[model samples]
Target: MATNQQLTTIKCLILDHFITFNELSSIISYTPDLRRLHFSHRHERDTTIGSMSSIGLTNLTYLSLRIFSLNFHDFEIFIGKIQSKLITLSVNISPNDITYLDAYRWERLILQHLSQLERFSFQYPDSVDNEHRYFEGLNQFCSPFWIKRQWIFDVKIVDEGIVYVIHPYKKRCMSSIALTNLTYLSLRIFSLNFHDFEIFIGKIHSKLITLSVNISSNDITYLDAYRWERLILQHLPQLERFSFQYLDHVDNEHRYFEGLNQFCSPFWIKRRWIFDVKIVDEGIVYVVHPYK
Candidate 1:
């Protein structure tokens, strides 16, 4: 339908149907004022045409891609052909597309083309069988560029595999992607406070079954089992298995307490998540583990 006339004042395009790179070019070429494009691309739609012509979308500041069966190499070619100073980019790559997690390629691509980008979100659902192989690749996201931006690679455990998610330190994690399938989750996020966590936890669907979190805290409220009990009981009703290790540093200014023996409440008893504490070299470790 868009093959005939030039769209003059179009500002955004959400095309769930994508045929090929050339088709995308042709569509965007018609919409000269396009500022955003959200599209889905699968292998079936990846048809080869003649040489791809260079096209500039100078006003296109936002781009989102839901990749179903496309390889990272093909995605790179598609990105290279589009000239846009993207301010925000979000991508959801399907399971087994590990190449999209290559932070080096992203660094190069952003620096070369999307240098003006500010917000970046990436999600990859991968198999838990290959979990060990992914830890090393995680270091690539820890480079200085990401550190300055306070971007952390978060691995959320699900039923089939882990979902690798990255977003700004204090922003919503995976706001665009629905994690209703998330069941078992074990995560260590040092940059979140109770408010941040409350905002995050409230967003997850009630399908989470098991949760294990490790936190190093400067805020004493993180040690308040009563607060956690109230929050989780109110929000995460389906959560049965629970484990946590909270590190209260030795040099904390607001004071430190290792004797908060309030974990034996009805909630802890029901979940069988017994709590204990230990003195590490740097801090006191308060732990909660399920019955073996």
Candidate 2:
């Protein structure tokens, strides 16, 4: 099971273990406020999916699935059952299923249910050594539907095999896009590495005035004010307002308080931003907000 008690207040989750589609629905029944979810789906074994009732996740906007084993038919049912206004959806498939590679199915699904989607990525962890058999004449994504959305179909030859990735077309680099003239930014990426964030901020540094970052981390580096101070000094010269919200599920990390002390230094004091901590349900939430 996931947990004994009902999780009523949790808004985001990244499950470490694999869960079947039905079990996932059961868990979602408890948390109505869930917005972002990342989980490993056990495709080979789905328990009690027959008893799975209609689930409503009205607030959910972001979803990432790492599909393990193999079951495309079950997944189609699961996807159809998911009722939400999804803004971003990503699926990484292992033990490739050709059903998922069908561009026509995706276009239909998106038009039917995911019309609100702004970004979508499909990754096939390819194993077809003979790329000709798999990728030959697979140009169904060239229709006006995909062209209007600017979602390009890209096939790359890597160590993994002939991998086809469907992603939003970008004019600049994927991670290091330069937004030099942008003034305000809010980042909610769950997998954004801390250092990569530093590089992203550097590019937008000159014109940025307001920044808000929400990150879930078990790493103590997130609480280090010195690191943030260095970043603010070196890159965010124009920044006038800043907020950092850190979340973690660690129960016994004693170093949190020690690392939090760094934020009390003169740099923060002079800026009139105060940091506070809260324990919610089963996780620790630390927030830095403008002193009022």
Candidate 3:
């Protein structure tokens, strides 16, 4: 049995599917003191909430919505109606959502209204075409803010732009963001090269304490165990924790395993951090190392 008295003190609401405006409003109406709301939905042409009658979630401090169909106007209106108390906001691509051919316009449009956002996660899946389209859109979208002195304190791009931009030159281009204030970063598809990886670590080494990189170690044909350790310990000096997903096809599994243990030694490790190493082929293996 339901009672009206049980509704007033609700603080958080999370929904897995898209809800109509009326349905969202009814939920909001039932909880006057709601503080957090998270929504994740896919495939369907979902609606973005905006200018609701119950826009009085005074205690609201966090809001995250991940819907497949979000445009500039939708974001503009949605952000306008959000209560100022929000401190954390995140959105990710739905697992089964079909992506548009190009997200350049979409990314440009959405980021224009994100000046006040604190945390962001944007993903476009893993495919050659999608990689090109996602970063082309992302690079252009962020170009305007490149010279601006604001920091994306926490940012994540998962399996989105790695395949298209996989060289030292591209890494230098990416470092233009000058993530001076960035403290947390997680990347899923950094291409398979040690030089490019070195430049990347050098670019953000100072500010980042947490890092995750997943790439095929098979591409590192010349990167014997020694070169790998030198690159990380020398350039990524501040990295307290390090994680690598080796994807080599060579039969030298024993050598790679020995190298892994050597590199994760405490002598070269810096800071106190969390590490997660995940390797995938026909089967997947995940190893976690944390500094205590």
TM-score per candidate: 0.58, 0.55, 0.41
Candidate 1 clashes between residue pairs 3 or more apart in a chain or in different chains:
none
Selected candidate, larger TM-score, 1 vs 3: 1
Worst 10 residues of 3 by lDDT: 162-171
169-282 in candidate 1: lDDT tens per residue? Answer: 884555633578998988896857887777777776647888888986566677788888888888778888888888877776654454467787887888888888899998
Looking at model 3, residue 1 earns an lDDT score of: 18
Point to the candidate with the largest TM-score: 1
Residue 38 in candidate 1, Cα distance off native in Å: 0.4
TM-score of 2: 0.55
Best of the two (1, 3) by lDDT:
1
Task: Score candidate 1 by lDDT.
Answer: 0.80
The lDDT values for all models are: 0.80, 0.79, 0.51
Model 1, C-alpha of 204: deviation from truth (Å): 26
In the predicted model 2, the residue pairs found to clash are none
Clashes of each: 0, 0, 1
In Å, residue 19's CA in model 1 sits off its true spot by 3.1
